[model samples]
Target: MANLESFIRSAEHGSFSEAGRRMSLTPAAVSRNVAMLERNLGVRLFHRSTRRLTLTEAGEAFRVGIAEKLDGIQAAIAEVATGGGEPAGTLKVSLPPSLGLTYILPLLPGLLARHPGIRPEWHFESRPVDLVAEGYDAAIGGGFELSPGVVARALAPAHIIAVASPGYMAGRVRPADPAGLRSLEGVVMRAPRTGRIRRWTMRDAAGQEMPVLLPESVVVNDPVAMREAALLGLGAAMLAVPDALPALESGQLIRLVPRWYADAGAISLYYASRTLVPRKTRVFVDWVTDAFGKQKLAERFAGSLM
Candidate 1:
C-alpha cells in the first residue's frame, strides 16, 4: 500500500523517473510496484505507452483521494511533532525585494522567538514565481497574478509616492503642481514596462487622473537603489511609501508635490493552496498578520507628508 501510494504521487508529479528520484526509489521499482497494485485491484490506474503515460479514470480518482490523505498525514505529523506548542519546520517563502528588506527582515526576531524550532528561508526576487513548480511555500508581491486554486492574503495597500531629496530640490525649481512635472528631470525605473523612460501617474486634488512624463536623467530598476539616489539628490522619482518613509522622516527625501499622488495599488501574500499548506507557511502568515495589526507601519514610515 505504501509503495502504491508513492507510485501514485510520483505519477502525479508528471514523470515516473522524476517521481522515482523524489521517492528515493528506482524507476523500474516504481513501475513494477504500481503495476502490481493495479493487478491486485483489477483496475487500470495508468494507460502506458512509449510516447506518453496518462492517467486512467480509476487512477485519477485514486490520485485525488491519495492527495487529500497525504495532506492530512502531513498536517497530523506537524501537529504531533510540535506537541501543540511552537511550529517546527523549514519554511520557504519568496518576496519582492523592497518589501522583504523593509518589512519581513526587521520582524524576523519576533517570529523566531515565537517559533524557535521553525526556520524561514526567504527569496528576495524582483520577478514572479510558480509556487508549486518552484517548490515555494508562499510568495509576497505587489500584486496577485497567480493562477486560480492559489490562496491570497492581503498584506497592505502598496502606495507609490513621488519624492526627491532635499538637497536635489534645494536650489532647483520644483514642480509647483502636477502640470509643472514636464520640466522636472525625473529618475525612474528601467524595466520592460518602463521602456526608454517612465511616467509617474498621479491624481489631482479634484479627482483628476494624469500621467506625468518628466525629463529623465537616471533610470534604474532596483527600488532600494532608487531610494538611495533620491536621498543623494539624484532626481524626483516614484517609490513605495514604506520604502521612502525612513528617508522622509530623516528629511533626506521630501514629497515632490502635494497635489500629485503616485498610486501603485495593493500588495498581497499568496500561496499555492490551503488544502496542502505546510506548517511553515501557516506560521509565517500568522506572524505577519499579527505584525500588521499592531503597527502603524505606513504612517510611521511615510512621515508627516503622507
Candidate 2:
C-alpha cells in the first residue's frame, strides 16, 4: 500500500519531491518506494529524466486502474471512519473567477454555516484543471472536457450577449440586427488555450444563427476585465448574461441586439466518480445545485434577449 501510494502520488505530481511533500516523506524515500513497486510489478512505470518525468504506456494503464480503486478504497474507509457523521474535511474546489465572484461566492457564508465541519479552499482561474490529478475535490465552470472517472452536473445554461455601457451606445445607432454590430468598436476576448481573438456568432429569437464581425478596439483574456472594458466604454463586448446581469440591473451597462444571444454551453459542477462519494463532496454538490434552483439562475443565465 505504501509503495502504491507513493507511485500514485508521484504520477499525479510528476515530481518525486512534490509527491514527497504531499506524503510527508523525503524525495529519496518516495523514489525508493516507487522503485520497489516497479520491481514487484515487473514493469517500468516511468521514464525518469533530470529535467522531466513521464509515464510509460504500462504506467498509464496502471495509473488508470489504480487511481479508481484507490479512490474507492479511501472513500469506503472515510465513510466507516465518519460513521455517517456530518461531512467534515478541507474541500478543495476550482471555479472561474468572474462567475465565482458574481454568483457562487455570495452563497459561501451560508454553506459554511450549514456545514460547520467542512472547510473550503477555492481556486479561481479560467484555465481548466485535472480534478483527480491535481487533487481538486470539485470544479465549477463551463467548457471543461469531461475526463474519464469524472462527472459533471449542470448548474445552468451559459448564454452570452453583446453589451456596452449606455454612455457608449447613446450616440451610436442601436444595431437593428447582427450585421449592424460590425460598425461598432468591439471589445473582444482572446482565447486562453488559443491566442486568437474569439469570433462572435449569436442566435436570434427565431433560432437563426448570425455571425457578427466586430472591429476590435480592445482585446482581453479575462471575462471580468472584458466587462470592465465595456463599462468603461472602451467598446462593446460579448459577455455571459450572468456576468453582465448585475451591471445591467444597476444601469451601468445595457444589452445590445436585444433579440440575440450565443450559446456557450452550461456551467457545471464536476467531481470524481466513486461508488461511495465522500460526504463532503456530496453535500457541496447538493448545496450548490439547490442554491442555483432557489435563485432561479437557470432562467437568468439563459438571458432575457429571447
Candidate 3:
C-alpha cells in the first residue's frame, strides 16, 4: 500500500521530494519505496534524472489502472474505521459561487457539526468540472454533461427570472408581456464557454415560451454581477430565482413579469460511480437533499411564488 501510494503521489507531483513533503516523509524514503515497488513488479516506473522525472510508458499504464482503485480502498478503510461513527476525510467539492454562498454555505455548519471529522475543501466556479479527472469528490451546479462513470442527483430546478431595482422601474412603465421588455435597458450575461451574450427566453403562466430581446446597456460574464448591476439600477437583468430571491424578498428588486421564468435545467449534485460509495459523499448527498426538502426549496427554486 505504501509503495503504491508513494508511486502515485510521486507521479502526480513529478518529484519524489514533493511527494515526500505531501506524505510527511523524506525524499529518500519515497524513492526507496518506489524502487522496491519497481523491483517487485520487474519494470521501471519512472525515468529519473537530476533535472526532471518522467513516467515510463509502463508507469502511465499502472498509474491509470490503480488510481481509482486506490481511492476506493482508502474510502473503504475510512468507512470501516468509522463504522457506526461519523464519516471522516477531506471532502473536495466544486460549486457555483453565488448559488453556493447564498444557498449551500449556510447548510455546511450543520453538516460539519454532525460529522465533525469531515473537512471541506470547496472551489467556487461557474464552469462545469471533470469530477474524476480533476480528483473532485463531488460538484454542485447545473448544466454539467455527465460522462460515463458519473451520476447526478437533482436538488432543485434552476429557474431564471427577469428583475430590476424598483428605482429603475419607477419611471418606466412596467412590462405587461415579454414584448414589453424589448424597450427596457438590459443587463445581460455572456456565456462563459461561448463568450456570446446570452438571450432570454421565458415561459409564461400558460406555458408558452418565447424569446425576448432587450436593448443591452450593460454586459457582464457572471450571474452575481448581473444581479449587482440590476441592484444598481443599471438595467433589467435575467437572473436565477435563487440568486435573485434575497433581493426580491428584501424589496430591493422586483420581477418584471410575475408569472414568467426561464428554465435552465435542474441543479444537481454530481459524483463518481463505485460499488462501495464513499461514506463522506453519501452523507453529504443525503444531508443536502434533506435540507432542501425541509426548507421546501424545490418549489421556490422552481419559481413558484405567491
TM-scores, all candidates, are 0.72, 0.80, 0.86
lDDT tens readout by residue for model 2, 1-306 = 668777877888899998787556799999999999999999999999997668999999998876647777656654664578888766889999888988888989998998887878899998889997777889998888788889999998888899999999988999987788989999998998899898868887688889978887899988889999999998889998888999989999998888898888888999988889889889999999999999988988886433
On residues 1-306, what C-alpha lDDT tens digit does candidate 1 reach at each position? 445644555566756676566445687877887888888888888887765578889888877777746545555555655666667665778988777887888889988887787767789987778776666778887655767557778767666777888878888887776667667667778765445454567775577777777666788877787888787787888888888876777888888776667666667778766454556678788888778768966444432236
Q: Would you list the clashing residue pairs of candidate 2?
A: none
- Per-residue lDDT of 1-306 in model 3, one digit per residue for the tens? 678778987998899998787556799999999999999999999999997679999999998887757667655655675684778767889999998998888999999999887879899998999998887889999888899778999988888888899999987999887778888999998998998989878887687887878887899999889999999999999889888988999999999888888888999999987766778888988988899899988887776452
Q: Which residue window of length 10 is worst by lDDT in model 2?
A: 73-82
Rank order (by TM-score, best first) = 3, 2, 1
Kindly report which residue pairs in candidate 1 clash with one another: 245-301
Please report the TM-score between candidate 3 and the true structure. Answer: 0.86
Which is superior by TM-score, 1 or 3? 3
How far residue 181's Cα lies from its native spot in candidate 2, in Å, is 0.7
Candidate-wise lDDT, in order:
0.71, 0.86, 0.86
